[model samples]
Target: MNSSWNPTHGWEDLVSAALVGTDRRPLPSGAATPEAELFDHAALLTVRARAGQTPREGRPLEAAPQERQPEVSRAAGDRLARILGGERPRLLTEWLQAAAARGHRLSPHLLPELLDQAARDRSIRPHLGVLAGARGRWLAGLNPAWGFLLEEVTAPGAAHETWELGTSGDRKAHLGAVRAADPARARHLLEETWEKETPQDRAAFLEILADGLSLDDEPFLENALDDRRREVRHEAADLLTRLPGSRLALRMAERAAACLHTENGELHIAPPLACDAAMERDGVRAKPPRGTGERSWWLQQIVARAPLEIWPRLFGRPPGELVRMKIPDWGREVMAGWVRATVLQGDPEWARVLFAWDPLADLLAVLPRKDREDVAAGFVRRHGLDGQLIMVLGGAAAPWGPDLALAVLEKILQVSGTQPWNLSELSRLAGERIDPALYGMAERLSPEPPIQEVAALLRFRDDMLKELQ
Candidate 1:
């Protein structure tokens, strides 16, 4: 209240009094300031200072790099908002793929949100780089949360430094980038530090080999089979299996050939007597899972890792013919291993044959999408409505064609009343994957509880798809 009182002179004293409590350390007493008046004045000044505060002007942000593509339409932007808001996140990958195919860039305002989304869901990151455009990459450089994106845009020289001196994640990103550019070099880089890396790090680095997998990588992978770590051995075996001509596959094929043969036009299989040291060295685990016979477990591993080409040559029959032949109980176990191998190797022709023998979900997914749908359609028609058919259909890609859609609808209508529980999950899958064009067909279903719920979900999905479009 004094005309010439400077608040700065007693500011420290005032803060100390406030910290220790004015009861213990009474407010500074002076001619112009009584304790009661001092408290009131301090309160008034605090309120005034807070109310009068203004944000300091920051330096202007640098201009964003020029975007090559035009911004997406307002409708498309709105669709992205809905997708990011979790209305139908499952369709995000499809939407991103579609948008990237159309050569449209996301709106500038959405770049941060999209990058944040990519950070949380890494599956979308590969597609996001292109769709996010120049502005997104520019924004990513300024934010640590989004720094992963910068790896994609960084210069080759700078990326090399990041790979050499940065954290494990940064190094992995650099390795991925290098692998995409020159696969052999990536392998060389990893090999340089292979001995120094921990077992877990070694296993993780081995995964990068999958990116540029080829017969050229076979020798390194074959040597990795003898790694001290079981995981490294398993990973090496998995990669080697992908290369039919790899030495490991040849050994497996030879082992499988010795165990399996056709006798008098019927298949016969002799399970391995023991999991020998050689088999274990090649990545076969010595211990069987609980309740599994040791020989059967060993046989499964041998057959599953053997190259698909081995069967037709060894049995002198095409895959389709061999799969249909009658097999002894032990032979069935061997065939199951072959089926698993088909899925693991992604041998579509073998998968197609095995699916015909037994329409398993894993085999179905391995076949080409069109072949998968056709096979599923046939199975649905032959077996009538069942859980297996629903599973195959559920795993198939979305926007189910007219024939598959109608087949599914007919099957749903046929069994809706009897299998309510199965139909509940089937209906949900139908909503997610069925073509919106089949709305009228879905609407025509009888108003039973199952059909009613499915119809509602279909309508909601239709709306969600339309918004995304």
Candidate 2:
């Protein structure tokens, strides 16, 4: 009865008996289970053994997925090119795999035209990262195909994106070496080509800095704070303020301190007002009016660009006073706009302060869930839905209806759970209100899970039959 068992599980006694007659001799390394007995005598590679399997514990529910970048970009780009160049469809995928093995960068000029041709042949498509992410130039945003790369690189697996760094004798060790202190170098590299890069490429390249902001990039970024292109200036300034020590912080603080005061034992500065000469020279430009004051949208942008550190100094008092200061009645919308800006910049110390303001709190408290849903939904559609959707789910799902979440799930899950970073984000975003159905789909789609068909995912299909009763 050859068997497998842990050597520590009283296997010696069983082995002695088996050797005498039952032939159940345990391997020196393993228990006396029938398989282990065979392993003992069969010159098996039963190196290490555990006495028992660990029991399973439940994990949280569904999270919208985050897509991978780069690796999938390489894969899809190569495949689409091969198909466009007239290879068989199957051969295109094979060639793509081969190209990925060889480590090739898709020629930016060739990728789109190739994708267009492949589309005509019906062999390649949106699946091609090189095409989907190519905003006619540099790849911006996550390609649904490659979204798993960062997740895989950052954390090992707890979710589907899990991968071993240097197994299988691949080139991962070299890749790891290059990525060892990647954050700083990569930002500099972007700065190197910032001027020559197209507007789309500029946006794409600048966004990468956001993923891993470093103070080391501050000098170059500060130069960009006043860039001719508004988009470049906006994103660059935003990234810099993320680092608390930058000059913008001190400047913003100066402005904020100047704004507030308690005159004769009462508050003075108006809470919201037009960005008069004092405000503009100070960096608060009343612009882009969506209402009575400058456009709420423009006010949001300028406030977001002005460092939160400025508020205390600009007001000549603390945030509590700033919140209490009077404003042109219409300024309520403008300040609320500023509060929303703080959320995107995501500086907690500042957001917490703004978050606590009674006026800001009141607006959020009474705001319609539908309005928030619509607003955020607009962002999701504009940006890639995968990562953003996960963020929303982690928060109050609210009365926005299950359909919004379901749509986000259906759209984003197609690329979920393949990478490590995405998995970590997924876990964070789903929090406790995870949707079980989405979780099941994630499991089934897991790279390690057995392939299974999911009936509910009819999102990507082009053909649907409607039966009218």
RMSD of each: 9.2, 24.9
Model 2 score (lDDT): 0.43
Which residue ranges in model 1 land beyond 4 Å of their true spot? 1-182, 196-205, 417-422, 435-469
lDDT of each: 0.75, 0.43
lDDT (tens digit, per residue) of candidate 1 on 47-163: 544332222358656788887776777887887788778876766787777676565778877776777778898877756666777777777666667767754422212257876
- Taking the tens digit of each residue's C-alpha lDDT, what string does model 2 give over 180-255? 4487656554556567666654654566666666677778777776566767766776676566577765565444
* Model 2 weakest 10-residue run by lDDT: 460-469
Worst 10 residues of 1 by lDDT: 47-56
Error of 2 at 35 (Å): 74
Clashes (N, CA, C under 3 Å) per candidate? 0, 48
